[model samples]
Target: MTKLVLAADHGGFELKEIIKKFLAELGGYAVKDIGAYSAESVDYPEYGHKAAAAVASGQAERGIIFCGTGIGISIAANKTAGIRAANCVSEYMAEMSRSHNDANILALGGRIVEPELAKKIVKIWLDTPFAGGRHERRVKQIG
Candidate 1:
């Protein structure tokens, strides 16, 4: 099973829960949730850092993080060394993030994306394989 870590701020708490359930229903993934457990105020950086650390440390193969607009949490995740976090609002972006950028972390906007659309993005991201070639050189440059 693939190991996945997830984190979200208060603004993303509900959507995180929904994603958790969706992942469960899909099966084949072992998920670890590093939370902002409730819909109360909480910082995106804390959760983003925790999830990024898990992936960077090899505890998880990938991570997903969330914030209001997805920007803040993605920025926070990207601050960690070895993490390529992509803030994706669409399936095409998700596909490209994984295939071209080799992103290890996906960031989503809880408020901006609908639940169904988010699910589609997640599926596409998970299913897409990194296309190594010229992309490998670019990814290495990022590192």
Candidate 2:
């Protein structure tokens, strides 16, 4: 089964929970929630780092991080070496991030993206495989 690590701040807590259930219902993945746990205020960086670390360390094959706008959390995740967290607002971006960039983490805007659209993006990101011919060399240069 595929393993996924998830994290979110207070602004993203609700959506994160929803996505967790959605992934669980899919039945082929082991979803780990690294948390902000509740809708109370929390820092995005903390959760982002936790999830990114799990992915970078190979505890999870992939990670999904969330913030109010998806930008700050992704930036935080990217600070960790070996983690490529892509903040995707569209299905096309999600697919491209995985296929072209080989992103190990996907970042979503809990407040900006509707739950349905987020789900579609998640599905696309997870289903797409990295096209690692020329892209492999490019990804290697990313340090």
lDDT of candidate 1 over 1-143, digit per residue (tens): 99999999998888899999999999999999889889999989999899999999999999989889899999999999999999999999999999999999999999999999999999999999999999999999998
- Residue 62 local lDDT, model 1: 99
Q: Mind sharing the TM-score for model 1?
A: 0.99
TM-score of each: 0.99, 0.98
Please list the residue runs of candidate 1 whose C-alpha ends up more than 4 Å from where it truly belongs after superposition. none
Q: List the residue pairs that clash in candidate 1.
A: none
lDDT of 2: 0.94
Model 2, span 45-134: residue lDDT tens = 999899989998999999999999999999999999999999999999999999999999999999999999999999999999999999
Backbone clash tally (model 2): 0
Q: Give the distance in Å from residue 59's predicted Cα in candidate 2 to where it truly belongs.
A: 1.0
lDDT of 1: 0.94
Q: What's the CA error at residue 64 for candidate 1, in Å?
A: 0.8
